[model samples]
Target: MSLDTPERLPASLADYQALAQANLSPDVAAYFLRGAGAEQTLRANAEDLAALRPWPRACKDLRGGSTACAVLGLSLDAPLLVAPMAYLPLLDPAGEAGVAAAATAQGVGMVLSAQSAQPMDHVRAEGSNCGWMQLYWLGGRDATMQLAQRAARAGFSALVLTVDAPVHGIRDAELSAGFALPPGLRAVNLDGLAQPQFAPLTSGESLLFDRVAHVLPGWEDVAWLCRNAPLPVLLKGILHPDDARQAVQAGAAGVIVSNHGGRVLDGAPSSISALPAVVAAVGGAVPVLMDGGIRRGVDVFRALALGADAVLIGRPVCHGLAVAGALGASHVLRLLLDELEVTMALTGCRTLSDITRDCLGPSPF
Candidate 1:
């Protein structure tokens, strides 16, 4: 059942991406590659990620291997998790299932998107025993509660409530490429009437978001989400320091410092750039994680050194899936884990605990 054979391809993340780029279509590439709106935050996600470095300690032993960390109370074999990016059915018919298979093979879990091409239940099936639901809260209490109950019934272990995208922002590439999730492929959990303000603005006039806009949830809804959910809830898209504190107050189990991969707000700080203050605000009351422009194993180390309890990956895994289905996805994950382990060994950090803020160089912010 193994889908990995890195022997025939790129040994590092960069090399794998180069191969993936040549194989993927331009529009598909642009969707994953381009940021939403102006993409200012998207660029910062990568630039800020590159700015931090881990300080290595040479004398200590590392044969014991890398640190396995947890988030939102889930014990993961590694700190990496697949961030929820919708429309996998477009990339490969397997969609979320493909991502789930690859994630399980790599000994990790994947957050299945509510906006998935496949139904959340089917996506959960692909990631069953290792799946978590990535929610963008729905119309009203009954609607939101219904999905939550279904996810719990489907055996989802957690909930990642995305707080960004209160309104679907402008995505230039999605517009330029003429991309829109078709009606047949609309988010099954969020169907409703279309509206002018929240409606898709393309020439195609895709009613994707419009049909579902009435059900969008806010802070009050977040509390309701956590209350009715059976498992831990991780509030994704947390940026402001106060938001982090408020999330803890609202009973969120954790927070992912994400800006929707720069797909929502073009001017927000990189998730990595926003980590420290959020971590400080929560003051260790809640676990803080991040996702955005994380393409390298070293990027994982950099995020950890900056005080992120864990990190999430977006484009690269999609690239892997797009290029070779499940096998390609697994390859990308394994490569990242291997790189993280190597860095941990070389830096004399043997456990996740050994990777602390002290190991980082001066703050880039």
Candidate 2:
């Protein structure tokens, strides 16, 4: 499948995934597509969403429908954003810059990854709608703050602190594939910053518990970043309802209900299954966003029905990038948005506000 021209683009998001599977190197595919442990949670993310059914409304006035919405003060064409993914250069030489351009051209938001292969300023310059920067606590507050300050100076509108997976997950597929970044491709945004160091492990000590855990960010760190960072901060990778409440109390601007796209904990519940609880916990105090297993426009509608202010997509965009650089990425968003509009029309929803829980029927799960 040569996806060199726009005319050759796939018709649906699933097709894009197939194209990506056919196109990407096996190592890259395994790294990007697989999840942690037995992949129980990975499969659940999509399967749970598939179990849900949307109740179609018949013969209602369908006029002036629009998917436009606001999140963290940024107006978006659709309640959609490209979730951050690292080292896009592996898929195409254009890399994060290409994804940024696609997001900007589509009038959707994008969150630049902390491990981006392209410089923050270069991506920002390429994407006017690129408003958020996703951050991982780089061992401590000061080192992490430096990245936050850099993002602010580059014109990003928000900071998304990924609080889950203080360490990398046990990804069996990635290990089997021997995934390693190709030569010359690196996290350009992290340049010049000192990497985190830990005391040498001693015999009979757990490496993760004795050494790595010492540098993990806690509630205090979250509060400090919220209070001191240059931009509004939103905590990503939250699943517990209590954590959602804690994030708000810590002065976070918002909360993203995610399970690290089911890549962190194999048995964790799907993002959709946990969303209503988190939303209830938030109690309208802040915006609630979601990610994981959002492959169709109907999934977006399903999320909004359950109380997600917006949704982000990770693998689908990467699949598109792997297929045809910026064009494939942009086409993927277009297909989803177009499908969202059609779904809205069929469900008798004229606006985003019209999508409520009543629009949903019983889920098989």
Candidate 3:
């Protein structure tokens, strides 16, 4: 059975979080909430945003405030996009399809994870032609090409290649809780794709670096993958400016400044902290987007001011999905857009272009 729509809908991301926690089981909540190791990077991701103070302006014409922007030729009503997250079925049976309906209704883009519970075709058919597919180089070159082709055929406009995780991070919280994939859900998109198989380890070999490293793709492989994809390719999980430049050079159409939502590398720098250098490095060569620690409309404003072409939201989307099906997800998007509009009006910014660096104070970091 689906959850009841609360009398007062969630007005803030924190509200959604609390509601989601109350509705979902302990293991499901842990999968979404906990980060790798001690979660230092997770804490830092939010803390960095809290450190930045917006310099709001007053006494200006506010009649024309709008939150519209175009990224990589996709015109969105707001700069907000949903980040690709796996196993939406873990939250609700609707999964990626529910998200698509919500995103389409709200006029925003949704990045469907390759590790999703539903097939790309089914998810695409649900709603939102403004969808992008997130690809993981899981089964090597041939498998990667197959998934990209599938996404294109399924009407996905863009391909997001996640570069941060060659292997899963050490998620201690999930590990300790024995957080296994629930019985009914698995990566349905990857059903027929070839999967990597490793030889049995000898007595003394290291399990991580020695065994797993053999199957991982290198930087050169990234170029090859970019060349092969039919859709515009964006490299996600990029932090360093040098890597940003390299990605553009390697034919990446865009780069997302993310540290895997602080879920991949425990000590990695916050996406907000890394946004400036990467944006400067790209220098308008390609679009630079970001995702991590985006809760309030002010956080979205901060990211745009710091030089991101757009921003992606992760946990909040899941929070909505957990609380209600399609309705909850759509409501979350609306809340964010509403808050962003209010922020723009209050700050005397009339449009997306007006949300510039000058609107911000000096970075605390």
Candidate 4:
């Protein structure tokens, strides 16, 4: 069901987290909760959010206040979109539909994972028409083009090319939970590949790179992929400003400044910390978005004020879905949106447009 006749959602973002935590199972909680290895970047994501203190001002108009912004020609009611996550069936049966409904209720976009259990068409039909599809680029050139065409036909407006994960991350938690993708819910778009593979994680001394080196995309491959996609292409898993500049130069319409939420790489820098430099590289020529430690609307506020045209959320929404279906997911989104509105009002920013660089103090990083 959709959240059409909503009677105001949760007051605080933490309330959603608490409610969701109670509803989720052990595996679901761990999968959404843990980062790779030590979670240095995961912890740092929150710390960095706190660093961007909002410098208060004498409010001109607090009454006419809300948080809404436009990114990459898509007008989102908030400067946030649901991040692309795989296999929601593991958490809730509704899967992509639940996420789409939740995002729809919030009047924002949802990035549908290529690794989703549901087909692109089913998920596409769930929410508003702004759903984006993230592609992993299997079967090389011809197959990639076919998949992109399918996404466009399925009603997705944008293409999020995941460049970071040539293979899967070093997910110890998934391994321990015996988190294998069961037969019932394989990637619908990638049904009959001979050898489906995620990126090979580099071992400390295990020289297995040669075997899987063919899977990962170099800058040249990125350039080629960007040229082929019909929709606006946004490169995900971007960290360095140089890479951000490279992405834009390679014809990437946008870049998501993410370290895969510290999931793929063990000790990479936090996504939030990388935002400023990457935003500088893009020069706002293209929309620069990010994901990774967005639990609160204040985090949402922090991301946008720090030059991020938009932000993507990964864990919190998943947590909500795990707990309840569309209900929990909608609740989580409502909490964030509500808090963001309150934050804008208190900070003297009348609307999302008023939340500029000047509203923020020094980045503590």
Best by lDDT: 2
- CA RMSD (A), model 1: 4.0
Q: For each candidate, give its TM-score against the true structure.
A: 0.88, 0.97, 0.95, 0.90
- Name model 3 segments beyond 4 Å from true: 1-7, 199-207, 363-365
Model 1 alpha-carbon miss at residue 14, Å: 2.5
Candidate 1 vs candidate 2: the lDDT winner is 2
Tens digits of per-residue lDDT for model 4 on 201-313?
A: 56653445654575666788778888878888899999998999999988999999998777888778878888889988889788889998888878888888888888898
In model 1, the runs with Cα more than 4 Å from the true position are 1-7, 189-216, 363-365
Expressed as tens digits, the lDDT of each residue in 1-365 for candidate 2 is 45667676688999999989988788999889889999999889898888778899999898777899888888999999999888998998878889999998998999999999999999988887888999988888888999999999999999999988877788999999899988888888888876667776666658758677777888988999999999999999999999999999999999999998878888999999999999999999999999999999999999999999999998999988998888889889999999999999999999999999999987655
Whole-structure CA lDDT of model 3: 0.86
Top TM-score: which candidate number? 2
Clash number for each model? 2, 0, 0, 4
Cα lDDT, model 2, residue 264: 86
lDDT for 134 (candidate 1): 82
What TM-score, to 2 decimals, does candidate 2 have? 0.97
Please list the residue runs of candidate 4 whose C-alpha ends up more than 4 Å from where it truly belongs after superposition.
1-11, 63-66, 193-207, 362-365
RMSD of 4: 3.2
On lDDT, who's better, 2 or 4? Answer: 2
